[model samples]
Target chain A: MRIAVQAESFDLGAEANAFAAGVAGAGAVVTFTGVVRDLPEGGLQAMEIEHYPGMTQKAITAIAEEATQRWGLCDLLVIHRYGRLAPGEAIMMVATAAAHRAAAFEAAEFLMDYLKSRAPFWKKEITTAGGDWVAAKDADEAALDRW
Target chain B: MMQVLYFAWVRERIGVPREAVETEAATVADLVADLIAREDRYAAAFADLSALRVALDQELAEFDAPLAGVREVAFFPPMTGG
Candidate 1:
């Protein structure tokens, strides 16, 4: 298991390949990447993500540990970036490997659901109108109930 | 004395990221009540407890959690990570 909370951009393909290669007994692998979305109304200049440094790593590690405990995952990787990013830029990624596809897929989804609300990162969008902090959606919170 | 930390809009409103707070509060809620009493900035930032989350010693915690031996406390809005 690897969890990286960083400000530098990551190569999703490279990371995924590396993770898959390093896993010894993984028959299946799954990867998910989150990207900064361009607003439909346009003028999204950038997104600034702020995080609680000490807690961010700890929380993600705990979440990953939970994912491993609940599933038969062979390996897991999580990379979440902070700092400034532009629209269409990758913000974070998660990859899971397991002997079977079901465990790999379910663990990846569980990681995402927990990370969306539990991680200590906040996002602010800078647009032509102004900058505004993204509010945590009720739906996102509700999404946690499934797991 | 305890180290108090704020993040995002909480830091923006409180005008500082962290501070050493001298207090006699017994719990997270007590500390917040004291901060709200300090000035309007804190009062405004803490006006709605439901919108805020607390952490004691870098662990997510409830406002009513005790602070007897906690060395650090943090306040911020709900996380929008992922």
Candidate 2:
């Protein structure tokens, strides 16, 4: 498994090919990309993300391990962005390679659900009124409950 | 000896982010009470335990739990994490 947390955008095809290279038996690979949106009504201000240096990696690694356990995936990659990100920027990516697409897909979704709820990152939103630290959305917690 | 840390609003109320203290108390609640008795700021900071969350050794944990071999305790609002 490979995990990367960077402020740079990644090439999906490049990552997909790289992940599939060693697959002597696996015939399927899946990739998921999460991009920052530029929706007009999105009401996004400047985004400030904060994280604990060592704990962030520890948490995400655990999340990835969970996905592999549940889905029996061959390999995985988790790439997340930090620092100030504007709308339309690439926020993160999770890619899974497995013998079958079903395992790959399930592992990918599981990783996201766990990350949305458990990772230790806080977002500060700057609106026209002022800046406010974003609270844990009920929807995020709800997302994890489905699993 | 242990170091207690408060973040965000908790820090704002307590006026300091961290403090080191020795305690005869065996649990997190007792430690909180010790801080609360020190100042009105501590009282306000810990006014509602229901509104707060604690992390022992940087992992989310409960306050009613015993504090054995724990070097750090951090308090913050509900994890608004992603």
Tell me, what's the RMSD of every candidate?
A: 0.7, 3.0
Off by over 4 Å in 1: none
lDDT tens string, model 1, A1-147?
999999999999899999999999999999999999988888899999999999999999999999998897899999999999999999999999999999999999999999999999999999988889999999999999999
In model 2, the runs with Cα more than 4 Å from the true position are A7-13, A22-24, A38-43, B6-25, B39-48, B80-82
Score each candidate by Cα lDDT.
0.96, 0.76
Q: How well is candidate 1 docked (DockQ)?
A: 0.94
Using alpha carbons, what is the TM-score of model 2?
A: 0.81
Can you write out model 2's per-residue Cα lDDT over A1-147, one digit (the tens) per residue? 888877676787788788789555675788878766543666776665555445568879988988878877878888887777776666678888788888888878888878765776666665676656667767877888778
Clash-forming residue pairs, model 2: none
Query: What tens digits encode model 1's per-residue C-alpha lDDT throughout B30-65?
Result: 999999999999998999999999999999999999
- Backbone clashes in model 1, listed as residue pairs: none
Q: Native contacts retained by model 1, as a fraction?
A: 0.94
Alpha-carbon error at A114 in model 1, in Å? 0.6
